[model samples]
Target: MFEFFPGDHVRSSSVNLALMAGGSLADIGRWLGPLRDTPEAGLDAWAAAWAGMAHQQEALAAGDVRAGYLAAAGRRYLRASVYHATAQRQIPPGPTKSESYAASLQAFGNAMDCGALPLVRVHVDSPDGTLPGYLIAPDAADPRPVVIVYGGLDLTKEMLYATVGAAFARRGITCLVIDTPGTGELIRLRGVPSRPDYEVPTAAIIDHLQARHDVDARHVAVLGVSFGGYYAARSAAFEPRVSACVSWAGSWDCGALWRRRWDEAEAEPTSWFLPWVTGTGTIEEALERLELWTLADVWPRVTQPLLIVHGENDREIPVADARRAFEAAGSADKRLHVFAAAGGGAEHIQSDDPAPALDLIAEWLSLRMPVLPEPPVPALA
Candidate 1:
């Protein structure tokens, strides 16, 4: 993340993701330097800078493609996609927002052409229309244990993959990264808002996996990042098909957070972000509706092996909230790992440094959903 400007957590976090997705720091510096102390250092300003970087990368990618440097082009295209996605994160609904999103998806597709991974676009049948997702598999022929991943309020399927999908794939785990209702393309194009009953989409994903020959239907798990922790936990409670559940920062009650005074609420910008996610006309109405997004009633039903990974210093959701979740969970085999200062992932979703937390998650999943070894070849004799 670039430190050119002072105290814009949102922009800094977005840049963190961009860098994690293989963006160049020097290029980021180049874009960020001009915005220093400028009056236009807010949303439009950051968006313009990011879009600038994206356009530059895309042009370079195009040149590389023309010069038969497909591998290099692929790398640049992926970087461009990350830049575009970051650019559109906070922009209000408009042509610019739509264009940036389209650019991100297009660049991602272009990158896939050069052997990023075997990606299969899936449309899971859901009550709330089809939930679009990408299944990144290690191999089409091998039936691998799959991890279904979804992100929080602002995260998209592409971001989730860039964050951890590649790591899972490298460890031989197939990943189904979905936009889900109220997130990513679902929100942007379909106008879908978040719902507390995440079991709906969870079941749909399970059904889709069941129908697929490349997935190990019996060993599926669900992972939710940031605000998605609540969603994943809810899904695990109701959808018994989820063999294991990882809440990447547990959220006990989103409603409780909203009811608190702004000074006390850990989830900042709730007044702003909630309305957008709930499709409420006002923050008050959104706060009222968010009462439905709590896990107090759901955690007791979660009997699956649960892994709660929380940043000890998470600013958005308190570590105490994570403890509440862990205590309420009925699962006998559950762990609440509170990453402290000594560890690298002690921040919100470990967005700044995800390796330690991701390592633990991957290792945990490997134990529960061990990969199948390749079949021995027949002797030539």
Candidate 2:
């Protein structure tokens, strides 16, 4: 991975995420240049720099909208949203974090409106609560296979859309980027914490998708990125409706992973992330709660077609997890693809170079699911 901050893993990861979301390198360089002398622990400085950039982009977007340059406005708003989300990621859980997150969501929504993107905000009723998501559907009206995408520890549905959902839609696949329990809107806004039984929420999301006229429910797939890899695997293990499953840098046992981290005395870059996401007050409590999140017993139950993608140099989840997942999965049609560090995409979720990973996933899906036909070109006005 290219480190924007030499020794600051947290800030460097944020940089990769920003780029993955289509942020401009020039603009990011300008925003972060002055903070070069700042220490790795200078979270406030990092947040301030990103927040300032977000404000500027928001202002530019406003001007573009007023000038009737809708496309330009959309582009600006998307940049602003990425900036706000980056700032939000650096802050601790508090009013400031809340404000930054809300700004990100607002900017993302504005981008959708200005661009007239083929996406819709959806809310599904789950036993836990309301699951908020964005559905990016292809232009064609025909029933299409849909993939439900869940993000990791700190990712929002909007970020998923910006990073991967739109690409899936362009491949003629309906992409539903959701905020399941424990992440995104549910965790940040509604105080929902991550649960061990992810299949419950997965079932709810599938139920909602099955009711949609534009979706081919029989061909639904579940994909999880980062920590969400656990969610995807767990869901497919129990949810019979899920025809396929993909785990992008997921884990075999998150609890054991945390324990290893603790034993190795390696602190998580974001100190507050685990406790907050797990709804625990301390690291010990969080570890105890995560014990039930393992897929050891469940992997054998995942009979659907499975694809596990991992980065050989992923600093977060170990590549061995992917291998173990593949070996244990009950699916007769299962494959594991590992990107070598030399080939790029060896970082977590292939953030270093996501193109190859993304292309592979799109092609893999095309082989197993029914892709919608390309929409006819419209007559010139």
Candidate 3:
């Protein structure tokens, strides 16, 4: 679906390895050394750099390494910068529960460089629906910050780790990426709709995260990506458990992405709108249903420090969304980092050259809320 050119796959493969294994991250990046010198790699790097996007629940509960890397080998057409320091999030045990279905998406993701964080999928009871989610944290970390990641529209939690999930892991935050109501298998296969109270299901995520001894009750955050970005911002507004919030290439509004991706103007899938989100409605009806989840009504609730990153030339969720979010976000520390414009910092997800975008995200989080290791003081001359 990314429809990337030749060398993009190679860089993606290496990055996948690095997202899952953070400290030795360069080991995976070393493969792209050849492309490092080429100009096309810069363009490829933008897409490849954000190859880590997605809300992975234990990468869906995640995907492969060797074969994917071998596949990306020797493609020298396109490459991009290797920036951003994201580590793999591991789960420690206390009250945390664990399980794995044969559904670990490694094979599907191996080729995609979508590193999954792995987790036991559990069904939580809610008034509107049964929220299904992955608890992606280790049970034994002395202390851990908990995160609940929401998936983008149509994409599954199993496959979105390369960017979103990997970003949080680098922060050493435990994450729970869920299928939620309107995204992924839940809506495509199951009959769920995007609810206005997205925080309702998210409460379950907080419950599961807090139940674990590995989680720090005081430091919970929500990082919503793509479609989930809007919902997460709204959720942090009411859910005190969410100590901080971020929406990457987030949606200030919804339904618009669906229209661009699925409206008659665009190529429609075999199933126009899945039963869960539309539930036997016409496209117009589907649009109406999703309206229930739009951020137009909910943005006011979000009060936490908000960070929104959007591509200046973004065709899907216009940069206007970021502008609106920056204005509407009640957080005094709110920020908007617009990618240059595909050539430099402004590509979608910084897809043309991710170095600037990736670094900006790391730096922003470091300032607002992060648990950093003490830096060694320079020796006195």
Question: In what order do the candidates fall by lDDT, top score first?
Answer: 2, 1, 3
Instruction: Give per-residue CA lDDT, model 2, range 305-358, as digits (tens).
Output: 888899999888999888988899999998899999888999999999998898
- Stretches off by above 4 angstroms in model 2 are 372-381
- What lDDT does the true structure give each of the candidates? 0.83, 0.86, 0.53
Query: How badly does each model clash, as a count of residue pairs?
Result: 0, 0, 40
C-alpha lDDT of residue 127 in model 3: 62
How does each model score on TM-score? Answer: 0.92, 0.95, 0.62
Error of 3 at 303 (Å): 1.4
Model 1 misses residue 288 by how many Å?
0.9
How many clashes (backbone atoms < 3 Å, residues ≥3 apart in a chain or on different chains) does model 3 have? 40
Candidate 1: segments with Cα more than 4 A from true spot: 1-4, 261-272, 373-381
Local error of candidate 3 at residue 7 (angstroms): 20
* Candidate 3 to truth, TM: 0.62
Instruction: State the lDDT of candidate 1 residue by residue for 1-381, as single tens digits.
Output: 233356766566666667766678888889977776584557778788899999999899889999999888988888888899988887877788888999899989898887654688888888888888898887536788899997998888987877785667777789899988889888888889888899999998899899988787778899999889988999999998999999998999988776674546534643466777888887778889889999987899999989999988777788999999999999999999988867566778876677888888888887777788546789999
Best by lDDT: 2
Model 1 clash tally? 0
